[model samples]
Target: MTDRIEKIVRDRVGEEPVCLFAYDLDRLAEHVRAVVDSLPARCRMFYAMKANSADPLLRALAPLVAGFEVASGGELDKARAVDAEAPVIFGGPAKTLAEIERALRRDVTRLHAESALELHRISEAATRLGRTVEVLLRVNLAGPFPSATLAMAGRPTQFGISEQDLPAAVAAARSLPGLRLTGFHLHSLSNNLSAEAHLELLAHYGRTVAGWEREFGLRCEVVNVGGGIGVNYADLDAQFDWASFSRGLPAVLDEFPAGVREVDFECGRYLVAACGVYAAEVLDVKRNHGVDYALVRGGTHQFRLPSSWQHSHPFTVLEVDEWTAPVPRPELREASVTVVGELCTPKDVLAREVPVERLRVGDVLVFHHAGAYGWEISHHDFLSHPHPEHVFHADAS
Candidate 1:
């Protein structure tokens, strides 16, 4: 935890239990700026709003990213609310006709159609609105993908058009009126960590698109490689090789067919995950069935990434020497403690059997790498638990 966050916890913790999310906007801006600046020519970074859609984070990212990638009508509205004139791309597996009409009305830069039926829907909506819309068909390539935390494609997932159906999708896109087939979107995996493997995947996409252009006699312009860049929750020190990725991207992009103009990346977690922390106060410390457990005031309802990913989240024990209660304070020293939250289900655990030096009842457990997909993906209303406060920190100028 940073000193600012520690100070916030100290000032906020009282008789009531403290559970909140702290965001460092300054750090976010600097990191995003670096990522944007490092990109090679023909590559643009689009912020995937589904990861962390907070107003402040969106505002911070508006000026840095090339545009916003929204997966729903609500996300598109949120993105437009922040910057009406900014470039926006709409992508999702299940898009309603209302959403299609909304995207056409909103003047989104591109619509990523997931299937041939979706292409028909986009064409229908565009024809009704009397507007010509640019579209990219999202393809689920048949692949032996690398090992990652999650895989969105290379299987029978309800994500994108199957590889065998791409030719039909392309034909439909060409035949559909009021629609311009600009490019293809091939986002296969999620939470991919290796830069070399990602580069290899990009090369594969380039090759596949080139073959499609040859076979279908089409001109592909934009390739949206949907963001799956990952954060190492188990080891904070080790992270995705962004520097190597950026340095290597130029050569990888050079391999694309000559007609390909723009390569877009819609990243969410990798952009903002490091700039936030989740802090929860320890409510009780006890041993059950010969296993130590540190029960916290907050649980998976507040931050579900750990439980959802089924990984032991990394955290630090912030010692707070304050005891206002009359009863004795429970302390666990020099042992592995499983951290749990105030939820009814047994699956409300955050970290299991984590080694800690000294953890007391009042000390705050700060979970790192939580800026994106922390509260945004959590089930906040479960069990009617109070929501964690959102605290944004701007650098002291």
Candidate 2:
């Protein structure tokens, strides 16, 4: 871990007093390339820009990925700015007519129609533009995921069309002249690491697509199995089982007919989570109610995962003096204390009951695995704190 941190510090020698997110562009590109290379000939990868929309990160991934899956018009613009050649696939519940028109004008590869109403809207937009729009019907597969962080794919989730509503939605889609249903889309939930869960999802989707093809007399040209590859934050030694994931998928694909159909994966967190680290500086230390507190300059405003996800980050102290270790500070000797940020909110606690060697001003506190939705989703300009800075690193190749 120290070796990795040292490599990042060495790469950014001239940069000053700025929050650095240790992003290994080469490693990120290699991860994408590996996935693309190993996947079957029909497989296609679309990077979900909602995970991290930093231009540098997108630019690094643009050359390696097949396309971009955007949830909003802003993300579409970011994808276009980075790589215009990469096809864009729009997916969201609240897509406006303007956004649909923009997607039609840009000639996106595919649009994921979420609802029956959205299907009609797309048809209307396509008629106005006088062009046929290719689309995939997003299906909701009812199942249990490991993480209970959110109610995804269940009742009250605004993600995709339910299995029962598929017939009516398909009928509506078929009624439109300019809309062509190309495939099916299904995303189970987030933070699911079990290979069995993934295999089950694929198997269910495969059979469902086969049934849809037979009923509608339309061959399914594409099957997009959404991505939720979990990251190992608590145990960095544990690596994700890509082999099991790849091996389990073929059985499901075998259910489909012997035709050239594209297998698409919209991956966001898995590609970017391991590649980023959030660095902050300690501002002050004090005692309150017989407990010592470490007040860091940075807070939930800069890194929002602690508050947003109701989770704790793996925190480490950096750039400490070896000689100062012998004479422990009063704060360090006291009982475990909460690490608060400069934010005004009482809930701005970064970590509670964190045992540290010493808490002092100018000490750097590092948060691991913060690359995914860390600064990308958590940042706000409130309280006048500057936005977090990003640093990109490339190997010597």
lDDT values of the candidates? Answer: 0.91, 0.76
All models, RMSD in angstroms: 1.0, 3.2
Output the number of the TM-score-best candidate: 1
Tens digits of per-residue lDDT for model 1, 39-75: 9888999999999999888998999999999999999
Candidate 2 TM-score to native: 0.90
Q: What is the lDDT for 37 in model 2?
A: 74
For residues 112-173, what per-residue lDDT tens digits would candidate 2 score against the true structure?
A: 99999899899999999999998999877666444634445755588889878988998888
RMSD of 1: 1.0
Worst-scoring 10-residue span by lDDT in model 1 = 1-10
The TM-score values for the models, in the order shown, are 0.98, 0.90
How badly does each model clash, as a count of residue pairs?
A: 0, 0
| Superposed Cα deviation of residue 304, candidate 1 (Å) | 0.8
